[model samples]
Target: MKRKKNNKTGLYMLGGVVFIYIGLFLFDSAKALQAVEEAFGVLKMVLPIVLVVFFLMGLVNITIDKEKISRHFGKESGMKGWFYAISAGVLSHGPAYVWYPFLQNLREHGAKDSLVFAFLYARSIKIPWIPLMVSYFGLSFTVFFSLYIVVASLLQGLVVEAFSKAKR
Candidate 1:
């Protein structure tokens, strides 16, 4: 029943988008065509990332054991879990939205909410940007900010854990 409702909502949103496009086309055909072209261009770039994410999801499902995921990211995972999550976040690249499905898959396999939040928060510390940041803001500022971000990620995770409704 919930799945049906979700599908219905999706269809409605798609229909609304189509109708809006139709209206735009009628109002200004050339502008509408340009909009469509830009939309397709964005999709073309994003599609590959989405495909890679799916491939990674499948790889994770096939190679990583559920018990291992739980051990690393689940309840009682301790500081080790935080370390893993923060490390993964810093290492991960590409748009953050592309990771949502993969994260959801992990959660389904027993990843904790706190760890997920920590991962998301830690993503702000882009390792590749560190050198650039240091050049612009000085080494001390960059280093301190990076360290603060790590601490903040842990706090964010702890807050999520405190309010999380999911059973461990």
Candidate 2:
């Protein structure tokens, strides 16, 4: 029942967007076409990344056992869990929003809130940007900044863990 309600809500939102677009088209066709073209341009850039993330998610669902996820990312996972979360976050590419669903899936399977927060926070460290960062900021500053980010990720995770516990 709850899932159905969510689906309905999503559909309604999409409908609202469509309606607005229709109104835009009626008012000014030129602007509407430009808006649509811009929308499609964004979609074209995002589609491949979205497809890859979904494909990886499907592979995880089929090949990896839920129990394993729980074991590695659950409350009892300790430092090992932090390692996994940070590693996954650092390795993950594309927009941070793109990983929300995948992270939600992990959470549903018993991953801890702390781990999730850590993963999201660690996404700040972009491996591909390291070279550019070093060139502009120097290797020492880059290294220190990266280390600071990791520490900050851990701190964020711990804060989230405390809040979750308080709520419980």
lDDT per model, in order?
A: 0.87, 0.87
Q: Write the per-residue lDDT of candidate 1 for residues 21-115, one digit (tens) a residue.
A: 99999999999999999989988888888998999999889999889888989876888999999999888887788898899888888898888
Best by lDDT: 1
Please write out the lDDT profile of model 2 over residues 1-168, one tens digit for every residue: 002225587689889999999999999999999999999998888788889888877877888777888789987788999999999999888889888777776776678889988999899999999999999999999999999999999999999888888887
Candidate 1's error at 73, in angstroms? 1.0
Model 1: residues with Cα > 4 Å off, grouped in runs: 1-13, 131-141, 165-168
TM-score (C-alpha) between model 1 and the true structure: 0.77
Residue 50 in candidate 1, Cα distance off native in Å:
1.7
Clashing residue pairs for model 2: none
* RMSD to native, candidate 2: 3.2
Q: After superposition, how far is residue 122 of candidate 2 from its true place, in Å?
A: 1.0
